[model samples]
Target: GGAFKETDRGQWAHVVCALWIPEVRFANTVFLEPIDSIETIPAARWRLSCYVCKQKGVGACIQCHRNNCYAAFHVTCAQQAGLHMRMDTVRDSVTGAETQPVIVQKTAYCDAHTPSISGLTPNANYVEDTISEKTREESRNKMKQARKMLAKKRSSVPVILIPTIPPERVQEIATLVSITKKAQFIQRLIAYWTLKRQYRNGVPLLRRLQSQGQTHTGFGARNGIEGSPDTSELYHQLKYWQSLRQDLERARLLCELVRKREKLKVALLKTHEEVVMMRLNPVEMAMIKLLDVLFQKDSNEIFNEPVNINEVPDYMDIVKHPMDLSTMRTKLYSKMYYSLDDMEA
Candidate 1:
């Protein structure tokens, strides 16, 4: 009833539509049948959902490789079903070589379709029990060797001949002995040098004293100069000479004796001044004063009193006529006072 064209032949009404007597009774008259068959373009390589749980195969899963079969199942579902696996050969057309056999899962069928086995055969794989036994044997041998080495180390030395002193103590003993010997040698050298110095100074002093007809007093009190002869002997000798001068009426020789005594007194006073100056430090002066007071027995006089020029007696006043030993003894103290007065002045 619509526009008729040769291209719209089956596109309009199929030939089977004419089988109906009225053709209006047939469904094809209202809706035309497909003009051409569906084109089979190799099925588009689609991923099959798991046949057991019907979930998308996202993890380790297996697919049925039976003829015209596209059933898939997860690996745990396959193992629980106890299905047997088979191998299929796939050849690479570009390399013209057969690749390794690919495993084909047969888990789509139930236990009725496939036989089930409990465990894998030992001869089928080598890594499980065989490798574990070998590793255990190696570990045992290593432990045994370690234990033997520890035993040998513990019993390395004999029990009877153990050392009395530790090695470190023996070394320390040797060090101490060497140190003591070194110290003794140094001390001996110091003593030898000190004695040699004393001998060098003492010989000359002894010789000088012998020349002066006097005995050496160990070493000199000041600078190793010979000390004066015995005081008592000199006094007696001077008196004898003074008496001879008077008996011979020699006034000049008497004067010379008086001059000699004056010189002795002067020397004594100079020595006293040097000692006082040496103790001038406040600490030394105080200590000397304290000791003098502590050790004093009867006298209350201060030991280191300051000199007074006015208290000092004149030399001429004490020795107005120095003639013999009788006058000399009395005048000796006067000379001491005069020397002190001179120092104060």
Candidate 2:
């Protein structure tokens, strides 16, 4: 039976047929024998289909546009079948090595039916690079600003220089006869005592200041002022003024002490015993040592003994016979004697 072939299907078939010339070419001469027998395929097999699943094309299908391979895929069907979307890597030209793998898009296929993607440029990772660079720049700017602020603060402070005191003058000052400016010497003394005076006085100066009522407006305002001031306010104000006057008198006395220090030192030597009697045991010892230079006596020579006031008969006996009690009085009154001295010098 003579079988007819459909030859006039399209211009492509017509063109191919027109260009055909019977000749001894390698392609034309090859595969003339039927080594593989052709079997009857089903009508469905002849339809346009998805190359991956071998199913007839129904809905949207992804087709590869590579040379010699136009494979079609039903990616949705593959997804429904729980198949993973394929990935591929691009190569760096200089190193001729593979780069990081990127996701393949449904519109394209890779070489050898791997997977491909479209619209993914090499500059995609640059977005993250730019963000990181911006953050780094901002941190650097903050550090620079902080450093500038620190430098400004350092530059703003005024440097104070302390004047050097001479050794000769220091000895003179120790002798309390240094004829330097009294104000300067007193200022330095005040500064020295400010640090050393903690708890030295029987009454704390802070509590005294508080009891006298601070002249500062903040303290007065904090306590509150009535439109018609109370008697308590007047009392506090009077106390404040009195404390100020006392402070002024104290400073004046100290200044006078400094100005006539030589004469005062002589007077202190003459009245050393009386001064010692006025002091407590610890202060008495310190005062004796301090006056030893003026008195021309050794600190070790100073001694303290508690005096029995009742044994001392007369006012003169309290001073002249401070440690000596009358034997007759001691014998008459075994435990007591009459005297004027509360404390004997």
Candidate 3:
């Protein structure tokens, strides 16, 4: 009688069989005995069979090609042997890993069924090296291009010298000139004022005077007098006129410069006003228009203090051109003095 015992490994029904090779049997030897022999075995007597298909066999129990589990099967059984055997320990081409199961055919498993595992070694390091080299090359090329572009840009830039006329020099020159001596000052002022003139007026005058003096020895080059003055006297007059002309020109430049600066200031203010108005809310625009109309009414009242009929004639004439009024209104609005709604009213 066989005794069933649960071992440390798992449950097993052990039976002492008539020993065929007693000398080879070790004390630890645990034989896994099949329930039936193939010759006397009925379909019901085959208790354990192939894990893959439950078919009967004893010769060489083929392990499951998928899970490597012992699944006994006969060589000539209806079920095919090695159906899921992986002959080659290859990785799947799609997955790039060894986890994929290889499907075997009825024929001997070849590279066709079990894919070649030879070239499965990862080339990540090679790819990374190539990419790094390419990146370095591109970076180098970009740096070279940047350097070239900067050099070209630098080479193309033109040098301009902005003349800095000192304000103190301008003030000093203005003090020397009298408002009463207009014509004489205007003539003398040509040299200083026209020094930087686009046309060669100052240079032309100097050249003509020099030429005339050379032609006629009696003519004085410095003062343009009929007879030649002494060298020292001519030199002294020349130096005086030169200094005076420089001062006068500086004064004229200062006046013109002030006018230009005022114009620029007005233009900048207009631009800022336009930007602000463009972003203003509708309510703000309406308020601005009302303020502008009120300011205009006040200005008119101030001008007409004691309200003369003769003075009103000039005022009426000024308002004759509607287009001119609109243009003036637009310019005033650009300076934030009025709004479009004010002009409408």
Per-residue alpha-carbon lDDT of model 3 for 1-345, expressed as tens digits? 134333333333232211111111222223323212223334432444633233344322322222222444332221222222222344456731323445322212111122123323224353344335554455446445544543454479443432344657755776777798755675566545445432442233454454455434423443444354454465566668867966886687689779867877777787788678758755456655655666577654453233344756675566654333334445555764444664555
List TM-score per model, in order: 0.15, 0.14, 0.20
Q: State the TM-score for model 2.
A: 0.14
Winning model by TM-score: 3
Candidates' lDDT values, in order?
Answer: 0.41, 0.41, 0.43
lDDT tens digits, residues 93-140, model 1? 553133223332222332222323323322313323344655546544
lDDT score, candidate 1: 0.41
Give the lDDT ranking, best first.
3, 2, 1
Each model's total of backbone clashes = 0, 3, 0
Return the top candidate by lDDT.
Answer: 3
